[model samples]
Target chain A: MNTVDFLNSREDLLSPGISACQGCMAELSLRVILKVLGEKTVLVVPPGCMAGAAVGGWNKSLGTKIPAAMPQLGNSASMLAGIKAAYDLVDPDVHCLAYAGDGGTADIGLQALSAAAERRDNIIYVCNDNEAYMNTGFQKSGTTPHGARTSTTPVGSVGRGKVNFKKDVPMMMAMQNTAYVATLTPAYMNDFVEKVQKAATIKDGLVYLHVLNPCPTGWGTKPENSIAYARAAVQSRYFLLYEYRNYEFTVSAPTKNIREPKDVTEFLQKQKRFAHLDEQDYEEVRRVVNSRWENLKKLAGL
Target chain B: MENEYRVVYGDSGLYVLDTASWRTFRPVIDETKCVNCGTCLLYCPVCAVKKVDGRIQIDLSYCKGCGICRTECPKQAIMWVKEEE
Candidate 1:
C-alpha cells in the first residue's frame, strides 16, 4: 500500500480531537509517532506545547487511548527511562515515549536526557522542536536559530534576535552514545514514519528523534504554511533529515539527493521571526546551515 | 465527541467551543475531483478529514480551516471558500 493507504490502515492512537493550533506540524507529527508505536506504548508529554494542548488529557477521559502522563517539564526523558525500567519488569515490549518540546528537550530537560542517554536507558525521546518555547508565547529556547525574533529575543535597534546558532541537539544526542538518533520533519511523513518505526525496534539504549517542527502561531506564518515551511527547512539545508545508529550515519533519501540546497531564505523568509534578518544575516545563516550540512555528509561518508 | 476538545480559541475571534467559527476560509472538498489519495486526512492536524462510507469529507464543525489540506492536495481536489458572515 502507498503512504496514504498505509496511514489510513493504522488506528489513530490519539483522541478524536485535540486543540493544537491549526496546521500545527508538532501535533501532526505526534499523531504519526503514536500511530507507529501502537497501543503497547505509554506516552509522557512534559509541560510543553503537546501537554498544554491536552495531548496528556484534560479530564477523566484520556487524550490518548493508551496510558499517558504529563510529567514535569525538565524530567520527561529520565521519567520515561524509569517507566521503561518498570516495563522491563513487566512486558518489556511496551514502549515508553517522551514527547517533549525543544524547550523541554534542549533546555530544562537536557541534564536528565543526557543522564538517561549516558545510562543507556531504554526509552524513545522525541524532541518536537518549533525553535523555541512556542506555546509559552515564543520565548527563546536553546534550539532557537540565530536571528529569529523570539519573544525573549526581541528585535529592535538594540536587539537583533537570537545571537547564536541553533544548537545541534541531534548531533549532541548522537555523540552521547544513543542507540539511535534521527532528525524528522512533518513535511516528509514517510521519512518520519520510517524513523519512528526504526526507533521502536531499538531496545538497548535511548532513542532520540529530534523533529524541527513549524509553529505558525509562534513563527508568525500562515497556518497552512506549516508543512511548506517544514519542507523548505530541509530543502534549504536549514534542517537535514538523517539517522544515526550502530555508530554509522546515513542521510535520509529526501535530504541525500539535494545536491544544491535551495537558498536559506526560502525557509527563513517564511517566518516573521526571521523578518528582521538583513542581507548579511541571511549570508551568515546560509554559512552556518551549509557548514552543518557538509559536516553531516562527512559523517555519513558521502 | 466534540466535547473532548473544550479548549477555546478566542484568539481566532470568539470564545466558542465549536471551532468551526474559527475558520476564515472553509475547505470545500471536491469529491468529483478527489482520487481518494487521503492526503487531506493525513495532513490535517485536527483529524477533521475523514472517510465516511468510502467517500472523503471534511468535518467543518471541527475544522479550524488552516487550508493545509487544500494547499497540499496534489490533485487540487479541495477548494478554499472564504467564510461569509
Candidate 2:
C-alpha cells in the first residue's frame, strides 16, 4: 500500500473515551503500534500508563478487540513469555506484545525482562519510557535524566534532581543479542511504524523497542509541544534514533546527519522538570550528550 | 427473561464514542475554507479525523479536543469553538 493508504487503512485499535491525559505521547504511541500490529496481536501490559489507557477499570475498557492481559508491574515480560510460548504451541503465527513503562522496564521489571531476553522468547517488548513514573504521580524512574526534578528527586537546597544518568536500556537489550532492538519516538511516525513491522518479522528471538514517550503532564510542558519536544530530543542528540539487528547497527535516516545540531539545552529548557538546571548542569548534560552522540556515530560507522 | 450481569466484550465495534462531554473546546470544520488536503487526518493522535466520501470528517465521539487538527490545518479550515454547557 502507498504511504497514505497504508496509514489510513489501519483500524483504530484503541477505543476512544479512555482516560489518557491530553497530548499523552504514550497513548499516541500505543495507537501507532496497534495500527501496525493489527487484531491478531495480544498485548501484555503491566501497571503503567499504557495499562490505564488500555483497560481503565473492571467496568470500563477502551482497548481494541485484540486480547490483552494485565500482569503485575514486574511480571510483564515473563507473563508475555508464557503467553508467547502457549501461542507457539497452538499457533506460532500469533504475535505477543508486552508494553510497560520506564520504571517497569528499566527498574522493577528489569530482572524479568533480562530473563526473557536471555531465553530468546519470541515476543515484542515495548518500553514506553516517559522518563518518570507518571501514572504513580511523576516519581523518579531509572530512565529519568540527570538534573531533572521529580517528586522523589525534588530540587531542594542541598539536592539537585537525579544524580545518575538515564539507564541505557536499548544497549543492554542489544547486548542480549535480541533479533531486533530500536529506539523511536512519535515525532517520526513512518519510521516508528516501519520498525514495528520489522520487529514483527523477526521470529528467532525477542524484539525490544524503547520508545521515548514524552509526558506533557510529567514534563511540565504544553500539551501541543509533545511532538515538538520529541523532535527536539532527536535534533539535540539526547535521544538517538537507531536500530540494531544481526549485529548490524544503523542510525535511522531522520537523525543520521549533524551539520549543525540543535543545543541540548533547547530541549531541556522547555520542560519545567529542568527549571532548576544551572549553567553547570547544562554544560554537564551537553558533555554527556556529545559523548553519547560520538559513540553512536562510531557504532553507525557514520 | 433474565437480566444478564455478565460483561460484554467489544461493546462498540468501530462506533465512535461521545467524547464531546470531555472537551472544553470543540473543533468545527469550515467546509468552504477546507481544501480537502487531508493534513488533519495525518496529525490527529487519536485518529479522530478521517476521509469519508472524499471529504474530511471529524469524529467527535473520540476527539479529545486536543486542537491538533485546528493547529495543523493548512488552509485554516478547522476552528476551535468553546463548548456550551
Candidate 3:
C-alpha cells in the first residue's frame, strides 16, 4: 500500500502513554501490529520489555483496546496454542498473536514454539529481538551477536562480550517448513507492513516473525538513531531480511540487490555494546555475519 | 466491600502514565513545509502524531520526543526544539 492508503488503514490500538523507552522500536512495532491485527485480535505478550511497558495492561485494566494478557516467560507459545484452539471453537476470526522476546522464544520457549509450528497451529508468533533481555538489565540472549557486550557479557579482561554467534531462529523455522517465517524491521515500513498483512492471512499453520527491536537504553544508542541503526543493520547484511514459506526462501528488498554489503563495522561501531571490539573482533564478527548471509543464499539456491 | 473494591480494582485511569516529562526535545511541525505525508504519524511509538482536521498535530502530553518523526519526515517538516528549563 502507498503512504496515503497506509494513512487511512486503522486507528492506533494501543492506549496512549505506555512506558516504553524513547523511540522504542518494539512499541512502534506492537502499535503497528495491533493496527494490522485490528479489534478481533487477542494479544499475548510474554514477560519482556513490552509486557513491562504495559501492553498487557496494568492495575486490573487493559493496556490495549483489545483484550490482552501476559503469559509466563516459557509458556507464551503453549498458552497461545491453547487460546487459538479455544478461539477456533468460539471465534475463529479472532487473531491469536504472541509478541515475545528472544530470551522467551530462543532460550526458554523454543520447544513449545517448535511444537506449535510443527502441529500447524494457526497463530502468529513475533519475536522482538532487541538482542538481549533488555528489561532485566540487558543480559545476553541466544540471539545476541558475538562481539556485542551485555550486562552478563561484559567487555572485561575475562570476557570479550558474547562468545558465540546469534542463533538463527527464522532460518530454523523456515527449514521446518512453517506456514511463513520472515525477518522484519520498522525502518522498512512497506516491507514490514506487507509481511505482517501476509502473516495475518495464513490460516494453514503458525507464522513466525522476528522483528529488529533496537533497545536505545540497552544498546547505548541515541533514541533517535534506532531506525537508522535498523536500516544500517540490513545494509551491512549483519541481519539478513528475508522470508520463507512453502519450501521457497526469498531475500527481500534493501539487502536483496547489494553485492558487497557495507562493512559490518559501520553497523557495529555505532552501538556502545560493541565499543571494546578491536580489529580482530571486527574480523570475527564480519566472518560470522557474511557466512550467515551466504548460507541463506545457498539455501535459496537449493 | 466497596472499600476493598476501590483498593484492589483501582481508580479510573490509574495506570495511565504522563510521559511528557521524558522529553529532552520537542517536535515542532513546520506548517509551510508539511504536506501531511503521514510519515511521522506512522513511525511514532506512542502514535502521538495525529491529523486533527486538515493538519498534522502532535500530542505533546504523550510524545516522548524521541525525534524519530523529525528524522523520518520526507520534507524535514518537523523540527526538534530543545526543551529548556
Q: Is the docking of candidate 2 incorrect, acceptable, medium or high quality?
A: acceptable
Model 2 has a clash total of: 1
Instruction: List DockQ for all candidates.
Output: 0.23, 0.37, 0.45
lDDT of 2 by residue, B1-85 (tens): 9954434246543223455567888889998999877767766777787777768888887678777667667798988889887
Q: What TM-score does each of the candidates earn? A: 0.92, 0.92, 0.94
Rate residue A238 of model 2 by lDDT.
92
Winner of 2 and 3 under TM-score: 3
For residue A33, model 1's alpha carbon misses the true position, in angstroms, by 0.8
- What's the true lDDT of residue A101 in model 2? 94
How many clashes (backbone N, Cα, C below 3 Å) per candidate? 0, 1, 0
Give lDDT tens digits, candidate 2, residues A112-144.
Answer: 999988899989999999999999899999999
Q: Write the per-residue lDDT of candidate 1 for residues A78-146, one digit (tens) a residue.
A: 888888888899999999999999999999999999999999999999999999998889899999999
- Clash pairs detected, candidate 2: B17-B61
Which candidate has the highest DockQ of all?
A: 3
Models sorted by DockQ, best on top: 3, 2, 1
TM-score of chain A of each: 0.98, 0.97, 0.97
